[model samples]
Target: MESSAPPSPELRLDNLRSLKVLGKGGMGTVFLVHDALADPSARSPFALKVLDKSSINSHHTNLDADRRARWEIQVLARLCHPFLPSLLGTVESDQLLGWAVPYCPGGDLHVLLHRQVDRVFSPPVIRFYLAEILCALDHLHSIGIAYRDLKPENVLIQQSGHVTLTDFDLSHKLKPKSIRTAISSAPAQDNFPETRSKNRRNLTRWFPAASENKKGLKKAKSARVSPVSRRKLSFSNGEKSNSFVGTEEYVAPEVVRGDGHEFAVDWWALGILAYEMLYGTTPFKGSNRKETFRNVLLKTPEFIGKRTVLTDLIERLLEKDPTKRLGYVRGACEIREHEFFRGVRWDLLTEVVRPPFIPPREDGGDLTASGKDIADYLCSLKSPPPFPASPSSEYQRNVSYGEF
Candidate 1:
C-alpha cells in the first residue's frame, strides 16, 4: 500500500570492500561489506544481498526468483520501523543486481540460541524479544505485508542488543481485511469466547492426546524441493495463498494442507518460533519432512512441565486452526495482551540500554595506517554520482522496480 520511493544513496558497490560472505540462500548471497570511502579508522559496514541475473534467470520458471528479489527491495524500501532494516542503496551491473541495508554485528537468533547455556532463552528474555518481534509484525501487517518466513535465522540481533528482522524475499503484500470480515471468516470463533476463562478451557481440552500412539506412524518419501517458493500467489487483499511456502517445521497447518491461507499463517509461524526459542526445538518436527507436515496438521504442541502462561500463549498461537489462533481476529493486539507479555513495557522497548546481549564491535585497528591508498581508489571510480541532489528528482528518475 506504500507507494513512496525509498531515498537514494551516496554509496556504491565500487565504494564498498567485501568483508565476508554472510549467507547463501535461494534469493541471493549476503555479504558483509565495508564502506571503502568511509574513514578506515572507523568501521562503516553493512550487509549486501546480491543476485546474479544469470543464476536466477537460467530457467524459465526460475524467472520468478528475479521478481522476488525486486519485491524484497520494494518491501525494504517501504519499511521505517525500528525492528526492520532500511533499504540503503541498490546496484545494477551487467550480471549482478544487489541491494544494501545496515548490518547487525550480532548474529541471528539461531546463533544466539546456541550460545545460551541451555540452548534456550529464559522467560524474561523470550518476552523481551517477542515483544519487539510483535511490534515489527504489527507494522508489516499494517502495511499489507505478510512475512511467510518467521524462523529464528531471520531475526538478527543488532549491535544495540535489540533484534531487527531480515530476509524479505518470501514476504508478500495483501490487502488488509476489514475488522468485520477478518473476524467473521474465522470459523473457530463461532463457538469461542474471547474471555480468558473460556480460552483456557478450550486450550486444556485441545492439548495433545497421549492416547494416540506414534509408534505405528508410517513415513512417506517425496521429491525434494525448496520448502518456501518465491512465487507471488495473490494480488489482492483478503485473498488466500495456495502456493506451498514456508519452512517445514514452521509451516502452518493451513499451509501444509494446501488450504487457502492469509495473515493468520504468520501467527502460526510466530508460535513455532517462540516454541523453538523456549524449547530449543520446534513443536511438531517429525523424522521426515512429510511426517513433519502431517504432525503440523494433526499433532498438538506438548509441554514438559505444568502449564504456565508462556505455554498457554504458545498453545493459543500454535492452534491447528488458523481462525482460532490468538492473533487471527485482532492481529498482534491479541498476542500483546496475552498473559505471557503482561509486564512488557511495549512503548519503552527501544529505550532499553542493555538488552540480554550486545555484539562485540570489531575494531578497525587492523587497517593500514592512514589508509590513503583505499581513499585514492575510491576517488578513481566513474560510477554514477551518488544519488540525485534532491529527493523529488531522485524519485522521478529512479530505476523502475522491474529494472532493479
Candidate 2:
C-alpha cells in the first residue's frame, strides 16, 4: 500500500516559525528551520530534510527506502563529534517523515567552492579543512561505521569556520573481519575489495535468506563479476540501492570495478575534493560516463602545470591502488605528518574558529529557509560556476550530484 504524502507547513508537527530552503537533489529537499523550542540567543537553527514519500513510492519499494532513512537516523543519533552535525529530533507524521539536524549557516563545501572558483586556498587552510574531515572519518570508522558517501555537498561549514560531516543515509557499520575476507576472495581487478565484502556480508546478515546456503554463496560469487552486479546485491535484501552512490568524478577505481571497496573510498573522495579546492577543478574528468569510468579504472591522473606540496598529497590520496594510498597502509597519523601539512597543529583544528570562506550574511538574515531558497542560492549566481566544462552544463551545474 502507498503511504500518504508529507505534511504541508500548516500540518507539520513542530512549531517552525520560519523556514528557508537550503538545497534540493534526487533524495529530497533540505530546509533551514527555526525550531520554537530552541533558545533564540543560542542560534539553534535546525536542518529539516523531507523525504519525498510519493517519489520513493513511485521509484522504489517503500519499505526499503524507509529502512534506509531510519538507519541514517540511527547512525546520526549515535554519533557526536565536534565536526559532525547534531541530530535534533526525528518526526514521523502521517503526511511527512524526516529528521532535524543542526543547521550550519555557511552551507556546504560545494557552495563554498563555487563562491571561490578562481581563488586557491592556502596550504594551511587546505590542511585545516582536510584534517577535520579526516578526523571525522577516523571517528566514524573507529565506531564501526563506514561513511560510504563522501563529497563536498555532504560536508557543511558553519559561519564560525567549523566543518562538519552530514547525511548518514548511505553509511553503515563496518565489519572488518568480514570485509577482509571478502577482499581476500575478490579478483585482482577489484582493488578495494574490503568495502564491497563488508556491504554484502552486512546485507546477508541483516536480511537472512531462506534459500539454500550453497546457492546463496554461489549467487554472491557471481554478483562480484561487475560493479553494477554488486550494487544490485546491495539492494536485494530489502534495501534502497543506489546504482551510482558517490559523485562520478570522485569515485574510486575499486568501486567502479566492483572488485571490493572499503573505508578507503572516503579517502579517495577527499583527495578529489582537496584537489578541487586547491586547483579549482578535479584532476580527472571525462566527456562521458563511460570515459570517466575508464579513466578511473585504467588511467593515471595528470597533475600537469605548476606543482605544490599539496599536489603530491592529493596524488597519493587519489592512487588507484588502495594498498598504496595513504592511511590504508601507512595510517592516518603518518599522512598527517606529511610535508603538505607540516605546520598544521592537529589539536587546534578541533577548536571552533572561522572558516576561510563564508557566504555574505544579510541583516535580519534567515539562513533557515525552505528548499527553494537553497536551490535558488546554489543556481542563482552562476548556475554552473565555470569549473572546467569538459562535460555538459547539466552535469556541471548539479552541485550535490544526486547523493543528498
| Candidate number achieving the greatest lDDT relative to the actual structure | 1
Q: Measured by TM-score, how close is model 2 to the native structure?
A: 0.69
What is candidate 1's local distance difference test score? 0.68
Task: Kindly list the per-residue Cα lDDT of model 1 for residues 292-339, writing each as its tens digit.
Answer: 988998898877655667778889999888778899878887787787
* TM-score, prediction 1: 0.76
Residue range 129-236, candidate 2, lDDT tens digits: 787787787767655566878877778775555688988877766544222212111112223233333233211122122222222211011110002545433322
Off by over 4 Å in 2: 1-14, 37-43, 117-119, 177-227, 231-244, 352-354, 358-404
Worst 10 residues of 2 by lDDT: 217-226
TM-score of each: 0.76, 0.69
Q: Report RMSD (Å) for each prediction in the order shown.
A: 13.9, 16.1
Lowest-sum lDDT 10-residue window in model 1 = 391-400
lDDT of 2: 0.57
